[model samples]
Target: MTTRRTFMKGLAGGLAFCSCGMLDAASAQHHAPRRLPVMVSGKRIRTVDVHAHCLFHESLELMGDAVARILPPTKGQQEHFIVVENRLRSMDAMGIDMQVLSINPYWYGKDRDLSAKIVQINNEKLAELCASHPDRFAAFASLSLHHPDLAVQELEDAIKKKGLKGAAIGANVGGVDFANPKFHPVLAKAEELGATLFIHPYRLGELASRFKGNGWLANVVGNPLDTTIALQKLIFEGVLDKFPKLKVLSAHGGGYLPSYAPRSDHACFVSPQNCDPTIQLKKKPTEYLNQLYFDSLVFTPEALRHLVAQVGASQIMLGTDQPIPWEEHPVDHVFATESLNDSQKAAILGKNAAHLLDLKFS
Candidate 1:
């Protein structure tokens, strides 16, 4: 089988050969780094990013000056959020054919009416962006999941009325983890709707003291650590067992869980008395690892390889925590990973996400 990386290298060679005879120096340079079209099994392979973000500018404007004051922009935040042109350029340069844009929930604390407005505005703007640039973007809905009832309605509106892909939720809302039985209705609704539930981490509030000095470990270590714990809670608490078909995508490479799942499997076996007997699950902890989808944002090829080994190729998708410089060259990252074959590379780069999002390309 012609692997995706080999096929791309072959395509690049052909492009170089043709450009050498036909184009001038500047023209060749202009097209030099542009990604050549890739095909696998007679279908064009696109690079669909599962972990990209955009700030809700219109929603913020609706929130007015007071809320904006507290949520002041970070460096390059304006261009990253408000400026679509720059975003497109960056995508093209990185060979990302489409981005699944999501905005982290910041309205969890707002009043019901105000929070509803925020969800409405965010969904509408996201729908508009996807409509305007069909090829470049699709978005996950921003829901006030803290209010499960409202979140159910908001999710329905986003998918049914606004045509969103799904909802982006924080791992925990006001310190309430998803494993809590109270959140089951929302999870059931998502499964009923067949919507992909993306779980991103909120700020690690528990580590405020440790992260006070510098280095932003709160975001670095805290983000994945929080996600790991949240996912484990869901698994051990039998949330996965309850909603077997739930298509959950965990950000930050499943936040150290997949890589360290053996520990979990051992915990139950090594010390059955130490484990919770009431929270019985159908399978071992490691068995649920492959049931979830993860992004390739671990920053190194070895880490990605380990994740794939643990979770399988079809469960891993291309995710560049874009505009944040976490995993900048997403396509390059997948292609350069020697551990993966062409089919695995193709699946991670786009096929898995295309199936997950139900994206059809001509």
Candidate 2:
């Protein structure tokens, strides 16, 4: 019989796990073992993609003409979210048994009424999709950060009423960094409810001029930089202190922060006058990474290895940025990380996400 230890090892460097999720170890032996992926005792390993994206075409109506310029047209690739079978096929191909769906905020710049309606529709659809395929799909609810009080209710409703896994938010609302005290109620509710906040970056805003000409530098450099700035604001301005237990997961492997965090440990010291003494941080800047979470979207095994070294393997989870192909061979990427042993690989693959999101295998 395959023990949990050996099965997880198989997941890392050998065979893949179930295409259809397997049950808990305590009950797996009662049923026949599925050959597609390995099982421990009776439980099969799970592969979850936490950085997948989706959009409700109907919601775009609210954007009116602005979408043509503001949004990338959605027609290029046939979407997996529209066809459940297609998503399952894609997931099976990538060795991702499940994907946690999210829609990056397009409503951030819109007025309150418009943003609220758009968010309502997006959250309802996200919950609907997850409800349709509980095993193969889950989602983070969309929020309207334009109104923090409203966002608080949206988050509560999403988790408690709709059963979404968490809330997906942009790194900043337009250009307003989340560290501003205005957004605290939402953070407080998330901490109280133990909801994971998935931070995807967008809108380089003032930096747009510098990124004007290039090989998609707008996204290539902007996304990660936006995320890094957002995180730094929270850390430097003491937002993390106010809500120490916030379950924040940063996309794009936590942007550039994990790669260059220790430098922040020195910023306050090198320029002591620059940092506000009134806002005292509980830990060194780099140390806060231990309290945060990231994805495995960083490209190379070496990059992945470095991220693990900087923020421990437990802080990283599998992310594909799926439907966009930022990571086409995600499963292989994790298995190829020479620095990670089976347990660390297993944790990064699905265990960390399962624990962070409180995923219940069915």
Q: Pick the candidate with the highest TM-score.
A: 2
lDDT by residue for model 2 (239-311), tens? 9988999999999999999999989999988998998989888899999999999999998888999999999
Where does model 1 exceed 4 Å of error? 1-43, 62-75
Model 2 stretches with alpha carbons more than 4 Å out: 1-43, 70-81
TM-score of 1: 0.86
lDDT of 1 by residue, 127-204 (tens): 999998888899899998878899999989998998888899998887889779888888999999989999998767
Per-model TM against the reference? 0.86, 0.87
Q: How many residue pairs clash per model?
A: 2, 2
lDDT, each prediction: 0.79, 0.81
RMSD of each: 10.7, 11.2
